[model samples]
Target: MWIFGYGSLIWKVDFPFEEKILGFVKGFDRRFYQYSTDHRGTPENPGRTVTIIPAKEDSRVYGIAYKIRDSDIEDVVSHLDFREKDGYERKSVMFYPISSDQKPFEITIYIANQDNINYAGYADLKDIAKQVVKSVGPSGPNIDYVFNLADAMRTLFPSVKDNHLFELERNVSALLNESSIRKST
Candidate 1:
């Protein structure tokens, strides 16, 4: 079995994998439209998280695909399911490995269902940044998640364009800077 990770999972894969490949999936856009009430925020103060929004055109969402060893499949799935219990559901997506030598394959990814109550839906970058700036949960601060993801993506796929992610990152940085200056004064 293979596991596809696009957001935090891209940077943080707690599970052991036999092999890991950098890849991109088409027909979806990674959007900060899901509300995280577990790993990122509380029920009373939900934080923004990423979920794939189906796109009409062929869009490439860069990520990593991890090949799960047969022996570790059950344990990995269990851990992933618990980590993604809030509004996420496991869905299959075809991943195109960056290395052409490797064939593209399908893997399961945890995505937030549109009908999920915790789905934050569409919001501009500034508004999303505003919410992320002040939210924290069991895993950690919400802003840290965004910052880590952005940095990870840039480091991994240096030439890829993830506008929504980069824009939100810029806004969040500005917000943090403003807050810091205010505190110092």
Candidate 2:
């Protein structure tokens, strides 16, 4: 079974799977539209989604491909289903290998249905930072996931610079400070 990761999964792999290749998917871009209620639950429930938008010119997203045991596919799918909720459906994606030596691979990607889901467009560093700082999900605060993704992006692709992530960190810090002051008052 093949697994494609574009966000937090790129850095944090709690499950076991063989890493296949680092790759890029063209014609689509990533955003934080998916609410992470499970990972960072709001006052209520857990949820998440991947909002795909038109890929920007000269912009390519870096992600990882994994080959998992066939038996594990069901479990992963179930877990993803729970995370994504009713609006997302699993579909095939063409992933171009990042390495000069490797060929492109076709894998599955979870895409959100625009009719029911919110799309957070390609967020700039400041926007993303602000979102990360202010958002909370069922599992925890959203900023933790953002920081991890930013770190992973830097570690995996040295050339990639995410000012939005940096801005997110700074903004979140300020928000946290304000929250503390409010609580104290």
lDDT: worst 10-residue window of model 2: 41-50
Off by over 4 Å in 2: 43-50, 56-58, 118-128, 162-170, 173-185
- TM-scores of the models, in the order given: 0.97, 0.76
| lDDT of prediction 2 | 0.67
* lDDT per residue (tens digit) for residues 10-109 in model 2: 8766556765678778777666665554455453543333455556665666788887788788888788777667456678878888899888878887
What is every candidate's alpha-carbon RMSD to the true fold? Answer: 1.0, 3.6
Number of the top candidate by lDDT? 1
What tens digits encode model 1's per-residue C-alpha lDDT throughout 1-185?
99999999888889999998999989999999999988888999999989888886689889999999999999999999988877789999788999989888888988888888898899889999999999999989999999999999999999998999999999999999999999999
After superposing candidate 1, which stretches have Cα over 4 Å from the reference?
none
For candidate 1, list the clashing residue pairs, or say none: none
Q: After superposition, how far is residue 24 of candidate 2 from its true place, in Å?
A: 1.3
